[model samples]
Target: MNDFPWLSVLLVLPLLGAITVALLPRGRDALAKQTALGFAAATAVLGIVLAFRFDSGGPRFQFTQSTPWIEAFGVDFALGLDGVALTMVVLSVVLVPLVILASWRDAERSGGTGVPPKRSVKTYFALILALETMMIGVFAATDVFLFYVFFEAMLIPVYFIIGSYGGPQRSYAAVKFLLYSLFGGLVMLVSVLWLFPLSSRKVSEGGLGAATFSFEELSGMTIEPTTAKWLFLGFFLAFAIKAPLVPVHTWLPDLAQQAPPGALVLIVGVLDKVGTYGMLRFCLELFPGAAQWATPVVLGLAVLSIIYGAILAIGQVDLKRLVAYTSVSHFGFIVLGIFGMTYAGQSGAVLYMVNHGFSTAALFLLVGFLIVRRGSARIDAFGGVQKKAPVLAGLFLVAGLSGLSLPGLAPFVSEFMVLTGTFTQYRVAAVLAAVGIVLAAIYILWMYQRTMGGPATEQVSGLSDLSVREKVAVAPVIAVIVVLGFFPQPVLNVINPSVETTQTVLDRPGFRPQITGDVAENGARP
Candidate 1:
């Protein structure tokens, strides 16, 4: 099982599905959807098997497969997984089938053709599978060039999905997204090119030092302070835009407003994490000194995003946009935890990435259900929905509580770890960042109160509760959130070694565990 090419199969399976869906006959929209779903489910099942079989105590990059691609340039078709990448791969694979199921009637809901057109259901689903391939590949690629290839490849399907299947303002939103992403990519390209020479070594036969784009090679090479700063900024700028911290985050609100709910799941729940993932994988790992140099500025921006996103979320008239803004705030905490550079903080950041996906996906899917019912996304249009749809209201409350980091919820554990870790290092920033938690409570409870509570409004009075399909789509996410909350130890055990290994590479000196003496005195009794 360990020797099997699981990562390769995981990466290729979706691409193969995309191709198969594309080849299906013109009128076979139903078959195409089924084919896509089948493939996604299979990929997800494989991911589960991979997780169960993963040797948590083994090598950092597991199931690594490498083959020379551009041997002259030292590029390779390399794929591997660490605990972080594995977790993300699982999240990506798991979400695809759910998105497919959730989007069954999305064309009709978006006022587009229900029957398949030339650019039809087949195309939509094919794009999704293609996107999944890119998502997994980006996380798994060990070669810098391969990672960049997957990174850029992702934008294509997403651009089409949003522009073609979204609301009236879809084109504008899609174009804006493309332009921002392209600009970031161009800047990062410079850094990638710069590294070819720096990471290259003396080739055999005394021709020249051949440039290599392998992460393993690059990570071992020495970079001067000035060069590292420039390179770090290049990667950081790209990630920040993707992460959409504070000023660069304008694209998300538009995307949330225009994109179909199913698309938003990938965009918010899985795809956007690429930014933070890049920060950890490339920025910190490759440019440790630059990371330390940029810490204060990064932390400041993170704090700003937290307060800014929370305040804007509170003020939103559109429910979808409100969810998007809340993500901005949540992302702030994730970044804060990552840059905190403590073991607990980094591990918490990874867990937060996972927990945020489920909670946010539930919120989007449930709210999408409401939009379909009332034909609106406005907070002012809804009131006393709980009276007519108690089940929906209850689900919304659960998701909202998870979003606000309520105790006994999945997000709470990660949030607590982040703050605890941050407090140990940067006390003032942690204190200020703590205010976001308060604001989170305000926005989440207030959103629930406004949208789900109060007297039954005319708009909501006739609205029906979740259908069976809707329940099926959302139930898994809700269950995962609750289950992971009480059993976070399993995830932490996997994440701790990776985080510690990263800290070791960076050589960051920090405090020993305060619980060590207490635990020893108590003789391991909890």
Candidate 2:
């Protein structure tokens, strides 16, 4: 059956609308807003359509769209999706439109002439849509080289948004963020270029080689153990910078603190996942031997980052910086689960990516509201906020519980599965990572206690509860946190098959990985 290229449409529909919005006449702020919302809503609808038709049983790169793009380099515009990709696509769709709504009230974009800022709402809205396009493409890309292009392209709009619409230090933060990402990307590109000869099957006329960017094609190649080791680190550094993994992770807190909350939410919640997802999908799969070889080193760093991030979070007085640091800690759990190399761990790692996005988005959004109300992100700036804003307190509590991985919360199941899977493999590492859970409670609860409870400060005396619009905006996200916590079966059902498939490929005879669990508990089994 030849249906349309639904996935390509999903990626481009938003950009087309963005271009349309961008070209509209100046001062047409209202039209720009309408166009952005419509475009975003359309993309979400397309994602929903794709989800229903997604085939979980087969290989993921389905509904694929491929064409020759760079013939000289052998790079093709190939794209496809599976359950893992679908989960990410759905998350992107849900979040981007909500971001549009969240940023709607700003005077520059809200069509409020009285307080309208200097930037054009049209360009701002167009950039947001463009971002959605790149984000979706990053997940859907099947070609390693194409994936790299989309991965690096995402920083452009985000840098603009941060520099144009953020705090006084926005430009500084934006430049730093871009430079860090570019540096990492350049490293990855070097590795990707070197990988071509090993990845391609076709020999060139001059005894050179044709490049192959397709994952399926590259999977057949063989490389020396020594060479694989160096290549692995090339890709690792790029993703680590984005994941903001410790030492390389310094750019995140600054970016979050200076950028607008909407920008913060998308950057951390969705864009950050591209890093960990890359590790799972690319690093572990494409370089299995190197992955096994580097496991000890990466895991050691993961454990250190877990404790270090939580410790730094505890010390932060700025609420936004605190949240950002917790992301560092929380992502460490994902890293631990990833290297565990078990079904439960990998499944839970994917789940961690999904649930973390939701909870972190909620936290950032709520904190943004607080800043709007009190004009500060400092923890000491607010006291007794719950008394004045019961609704806000309740929402923040939901987000925090998910972060702390409380039972029956969205993150609870994922965290439990991740830790449980790890116990079967790295018992000591699992125990230490569990301590990360305890640190989670400390920073999250203490942050809430300092910011939400105690006596009301003079500034907190008269604030109102969440507006109807705000309530409507956040209601579904909170509901999803609860809903997914209860019935993750729908997603789990889809994710397991694909995860097992990857596990099988990596479990090839060539790999001597330190696997755990019983003989009967093989990856192929349910």
Candidate 3:
């Protein structure tokens, strides 16, 4: 026990809370909700402490813990935190509490009575905490085996959340989500197992010749190009599905429409980003040549997602589904940034992950409020909401602007950096991708005008504004969006070093245009 096991504490704290919630007596739903909220808040407080203690200037991984789990297989129970992982952990912790608050009423509403259900309330919160632990584990695991375990474990809680608590089509959405995720997981597992033999060393050289699944160990070794490409595809396909890039993205709209708002936030806002994260952390780092070789194809898909998602969003009749489609478009930007293979591009992708969480969370929650009040998610159902719920309309506009990457908003900085960096490498892809922004603006503004700017209809009459609790839940997200928009240097500072290390691994010269504005002669940083 190295003084303080922060990583283990972060992982275990939620499980402990879930256990506590589970043990509460019958009819103690209120107590269970409070208990769950307390634990989530405590975990968030710990996350804040961890963030403060983290040495941004030091080694890539801090708070490391390693121990042999199975000696025969050379497997270790290991965990560590890098800037990237810390950023995600922080995002997860912060959002969990807000999600709890947002779901507090919805949980009761689900029961068809004005009061929360005994068993379902406890189970929902417990599942959320359990899910949090697995989420933290996914980003923090230092071993490939541990990462896979956490990755698969994440699906269970989310499945139950969607299946048990969703709307009329809940079962269909849950099954679809599970099947898609399971297929991807199986594909990636094959790749995980194959890497063991490739990673094995000669027994005579004081090495464990059987196998090893440690990220540190595997990253240090090299694989043949043909083998690396196959492995890369396995990992890439899994992530692309999770990222839910085009063609494979069908499940998202249905899931978003049927699932509860709180669950939608985590599914779309946090879990989906794991795909892009894996692409950067494993695919690019471990198979540099394969990544470069596949860049043209992947880049093409990314562009397709941008345009396809945007067009679909513009045409959507269901409000929740429209939000889901926009995420598809936003994810396209994140993937584009990653494959651009430049400092600005990678860093922007990471920042976009964080900013996207906040923006999308706001969008989903606000839209949920509308759906709850009007009892419908159709675009045609809402009209002139600003007259009755000006506060809600204002917040919706804020979220929409952020999603559109308007200047002086959080997303603009990262989105601009991504396009700038991508332009340096794949000029045509960057140019086509830029069209998504215009589409985004159209969809967001058009939706706002239809829902908030018109004459108040019967559906909108006498609707209420945000409550104190709702304000408490949404204010922090809006504040962060504004703060980060103006001052992105703090996140950029932490992100730059890790991104530089990644660029060094790829070690390829990014194409530099003859006309330069900000990028130095080295074509490194802007």
Give the alpha carbon lDDT tens digit for every residue of 54-137 in model 3: 888999888999889876767788999888888889999999999888777666564221222333678888888998898899
Q: What is the TM-score of each candidate against the true structure?
A: 0.94, 0.94, 0.95
Judge candidate 2 at residue 381 and give its lDDT. Answer: 85
Worst 10 residues of 1 by lDDT: 109-118
Candidate 1 on 1-526: residue-level lDDT in tens?
4478989899889999999999999878789989999999999999999988778899988889999999977889998888998888888998899888878767545522122222577888999999999999999999998988888889999899888888878889999999999899889989998887776533442334566787876776667889999999999998998887888999999988988888898999999999999998899888888888888899999999999999999999999999999999999999999888777788899999999989899898888888878777889889999999999999999999999999888999999988877776676788999999999999999999999988998888798998888889889999999999899988877777778777776773321222345434765311
Q: What value of lDDT does candidate 1 attain over all alpha carbons?
A: 0.86
Cα lDDT tens digits for candidate 2, 306-343: 88999999999988889999999988888888888788
Stretches of model 3 off by over 4 angstroms after superposition: 111-119, 202-210, 508-526
When sorted by lDDT, best at the front, the candidate numbers are: 3, 1, 2
